[model samples]
Target chain A: MKDKIRIASGSGFWGDLQSIPLQQVTKGQIDYLMMDFLAEVTMSIMQKQKKRNPAAGYAKDLIQIMKDILPHIAEKNIKVITNGGGANPMGCVEEIVKCAHKQGIKGLKIGVVTGDDILDSIDNLLKHGAGLDNMESGQKVTDVKERLISANVYFGARPIVEALKKGAQIIITGRTTDTSLTYAPMIHEFKWSWDDWDKLAAGVIAGHILECGGQSSGGNFLGDWRSVPDLAHIGFPIAEAYPNGEFVVTKHENTGGMVSVDTVSEQLMYEIGDPTNYITPECVADFTTINLEQQGKDRVRVFGIKGKPATDLYKVSMAYNDGYTAIGSLTYSWPDALEKAKKADEILRTRLSDLGLKFDEIRTEFLGVNACHGPLASEQNEINEVVLRVGVRSANHHDIEAFGKEIAPLILTGPPSVTGFAGGRPKANEVIAYWPALMPKKLVHPKVEIITT
Target chain B: MSKIKLIDIAHGRSGDKGDAANVGIVAYDDKGYEIIKKHLTTERVKKHFEGICFGKVERFEMPNICALNFLLHNTLGGGGTVSLKHDAQGKTLAAALLKMEIEI
Candidate 1:
């Protein structure tokens, strides 16, 4: 069994920096490069793309990243794992195969882990007594069944580990938990058993820390932002995993970001609800039980993570077409900018109300002032500029489109010194609402397929 | 005791889970954690974010890491793709919440 393995993080989400994977492959020694490209709403977007063009559902950036790093990857024998496959893992794998062939690299075994995309099976499952009720609102699937864009079960690290066992050099998945990509390498390399909750939990925490790429390694750090060095060439995070459910969060040598106790701790707490029961498809990790200590420069040792047995149900991420939303912004300058912005908002709303256009939700924000903090923002006495931003959400796209038209008119009719109307007209965008649900584990099984080029 | 920002003693980061936004504040030291524990109540947090978060604010204690996580419900407008606000996901909510003053 391997005593230690280094897994480097590449991409955080779908649109993250593409060069990150290449840097990790060429600049450092890593057993696996895990790129997380899927987000909560990414599946729905990918589904829409697939409907428009069957060959274009998966993350296209993955192919480019593979092409850039395939040469080094083949030379170093570094395995690549990612959920960049999005809605179509098979399509993503085929693209990778073509990339390998173009690069003159032969006999590349790429594994595609699928069966997570259940958009087509939602009706069959509903017939089989799978209610798939919204976990948050307790609403039935029938409430938005007609509008569902995508529905996928969150798969765990098991299938990826199985792919590794089968000698697959590159693994692509659909709707797999972001953490699974990082932990699957550890589980396979160290020969960690399925029931090893503590080790698996440690791996899960590592994955969490690495999932966001540079976020845990100093990029976008809220603490002492100025103190974090060389963010221009920020080094992505790497986990030096050991067999005893312990790892050190570090970065590549000569790299930019700092990997201290604070950074790792903050990441451990990001987007987490109920620290005692951080649930994944494979295990329930207790975030509160994690222990961190700075071992050396840019190295924080993480250990003593506790976890419970795997849950019987897998969390389902479903997105449906809720409505249309349009946002319009106009900047007001100098001599009481806050007042001018407020006046503009009032006038715009009055016009919308006067036109007999009803909206499900109409919201406004003073960009330079309370755009972020809202009521928590301090009262502004005088401001140089404040962007008057208004957005409306409604079922009728025509109403939203009309609302978009009203913003440019406000510059001449209502608010004075209005500028920054660079974008001509605010376009109506389709709103993809998220639906969280749970499905029985036995009902869905992950399918892994390996292709060689 | 003088009024001081939460950032004076602690630092935090916030992100969204659907419509809910969670801000995890970690103290610079054990003393700072104690100060936050006594002063940073869920009621206080909810009140501090009066118009921003229209729902309940639940705080969870993490004594081991000397951190407190506040989950603000029904915030973020509508979250992710649905929300029209500039800070739809509440990514900057932590920095904003840190502006809250406490008697130290």
Candidate 2:
């Protein structure tokens, strides 16, 4: 078994820094480059793209990054894994083959992991007694099946492990869990047992640390932001995994940003509801058992993670067309700016009410004051300026559009000293509402295929 | 001893799951964790975010890591791609949460 292997994170989500993958390959000696490009709602956007053009659902940016770093990774024998496959893994792999062929790189094998997408099978699954009820709202799938744009079950690392075993140099998946991309390499290299809960949990924690790219480093760090240096050149996180299930979280040698116990701890808590029951497909990791120590500068060793067997179900992320929403804002300057903004909001709401435009929801925020904290903001009488932002959501398109038109009128008729409306009228946008559900693992299966050009 | 903002003694990160916003508050030290455990109750946090969070606040304790996670249900207006707010994902909620004052 390999003593240790370094897995470097490139992108946290789609539209993350483009130069990040290049830096991971050029600046560091990593065995695997893991890029997570999918979010819970990204599949819906990709599905829309696929509806417009069947060959264009995947992350097009991944092809460009592969073009930039393909030759270097090929030379170093560094494998690549990503969930950028989105709605089309085959189409994404076809593009990557063309890129590699154009660059004269030979014998490169790419693995395509699919079958996570279940948009087409929603009706069949529903008929098969899979209610797919909303885990949060207790609503059935039939409630929004007509408007569903995307529905995909989140696959875990088993298919990825199979792909690695088949000698796939690059693995592209549809809706795999983000943590699996980093842990699959550890599972493959160390030959870790599938039932080894502690080792698997340790690997899961390592994946979580590196999953956010620079967040585990210092880019979005909230702890002593001033102390985190050179965010412009911030280094993405790297997990050096050992056979014993202990790993070191660090960044590139010359790159900026920190990898301390505090940073890792903060990331461990990001987006997680429960600390002990951090669930994945392979195992249920207990983050409370994790132990961290700052071994050296820009390096924190993590160990002692425990886990239980995974549940019998998989979480499914589905999105449907809810309604239309448009938001417009106007900045009111000093000399009772807060009061002026409040007055403007009242005027706009009164106009909407007069027009008899019914809306599902209408929200207003006074920036430079309580926009973030709401009632928790400390009162300030001497504020220089405040931006009055108003948004409306409704099933009627004309209502949201009319609300958009109301903002421009307010600049001239409602409040004085109003500016910062240079973006023109806020256009109505289709609201893609998320519906979280679960499906029995036996109902859906993942497929893995390794291809070489 | 002095009264200080939570940001002085603890660091936090917040993100959204559906319409719920979760803030994970990690103390800098054991004493800081004790201070947070005593003062930063679910009621206090819900009150601290009055008018923003419409649902109940559930706090989960992680004494192993000296952290407390607060899940404010139905807090993101609508959350994700549907929410028209600038901070739809509640990324800035953590910074706002740290503005709470506590005695040490």
Candidate 3:
């Protein structure tokens, strides 16, 4: 087994920096490149695209990225694991194959993990006594059965490890846990046992630290943000993982970002619910047991992570058509701008009320005044400019469209010195709501298939 | 003892899970952690965000990292795609929490 492996994170979310994968493969020595491209609601969007066109359900940016990083990664003998597959892994694999063949690269092996998409099987599962109740609200799935756009189960690192063991150069998956993309490589390289809870949990922690790309390395750093140098060319994080369940979080040599204990600690707490119970399919990692020490400049050593056995169920993410919404904004400038914006909001709401337009919710915010923190925002007197933003949600599409049409009229009749309205009348958008539920592990199976170019 | 804002000694990040939002606050040092641990209770946090967070507040401790995580339920309108609020995901909720004053 290899003594150590270097795994580099390329992308964090679906629309993350596109050029980082090439940079990671070229600017550094790395054994594997892991990219995460899925979010909570990405699958529903991809499903909509697939419904329009059968082969367009995946992260379309991956094809361009593969075209750019193919030769470099091939020359470096680096493997790639990503959940950019979204709603379709086979389609993503096919696109990569075409990109590689076009570039005259031969004999590339691509692995595809399937069976995460269960939209077709939902009715059957429900008939078989699967409650599939919403984890938060305890509501039945049948309530939104007709509106569901996408449903996929979250798989862990085992299928990915299987793909790596089968000599696959690149692996693509659907709805895989974000942490699994980083840890699967460690399990394959070191041949770690499945039941080694500490090692598995250590891998999970490394994945969490690296999953957000540059967050652990000073990108979204809150502590001493100005101390970080060269924000323009920030380097993504790399995990120098060892066989003993220890890893050092660092970036490339002479990179633009800083990797300190502070940066890593903040990321450790990002989006986490319970410090003692970070549940994944592989193990329940305890974030409270983690230990961090700054080893050198741009390097933080993470160790002593604890985890428990895996649960008997898988968390499934489903999205449905919640309703329609439209948001419009106009900026009022100078001389009691906040007052003018508040007046504009009142005029618009009064007009909507007079027109007898009904909506589920009507919300307005003065951007420069109290948009982000709402009640907690500090009182500011005489603000130079304020963006009057209004949004309405409704089950009726016509009411949303009607709300969109009233914003531009405010500049003409309601408020003076309003200028920032460049786009045409705001259009109604379908709001896709997320439904998280759990299912028995025996009901779903992950399949790994390999394709050669 | 002196009164100071929580931002003086701590920094954090916030994210959303369904309708609930979690703000993870990490202290600058162990001393700062102790100060926050004593003063930053769930009741105080709930009272601080009285109108915004309509549900109960739950706090989790991570003394190893000198951090505390606060999960504020029903804080994001309806959260995700349905929430019409500008900060639907509650990304800036941490800064709001750090604005709280504490006696140190």
TM-score of chain B only, all predictions?
0.96, 0.95, 0.97
Q: Write the per-residue lDDT of candidate 2 for residues A21-74, one digit (tens) a residue.
A: 999999979999999999888999999998999998999999999999999999
lDDT at position A21, candidate 2: 97
**Clashes by residue pair, model 3:** none
lDDT for A97 in candidate 3 is 95
Residue pairs whose backbone atoms clash in candidate 1: none
DockQ of each: 0.82, 0.75, 0.88
Displacement of residue B62 (Cα, Å) in model 2 is: 1.9
RMSD of each: 1.1, 1.3, 0.8
Q: What's the candidate order when arranged by decreasing lDDT?
A: 3, 2, 1
Interface RMSD of 2: 1.2
> Clashing pairs in model 2?
none
TM-score to true structure, per model: 0.98, 0.98, 0.99
**Candidate 3 residue-wise lDDT, A1-453, digit = tens:** 889999999999999999899999999799999999999999999999999999999999999999999999888899999999999899999999999999899999999999999999998987876668899999988899999999999999999999998999999999999999999999888888999999999999999998999998898888889999997889999999999999999999877989998999989988999889999999999999999999999989998988999998899999999889999999999898988898999999999999999999999988988999888888688788999889999999999998888989998998789898799899999999999999998888999999998
lDDT for model 3: 0.93
Candidate 3 Cα outliers beyond 4 Å, as residue runs: none
Q: TM-score winner among the candidates?
A: 3
Clashes of each: 0, 0, 0
Where in model 2 is the C-alpha error above 4 Å? none
Give TM-scores of chain A for all candidates: 0.99, 0.98, 0.99
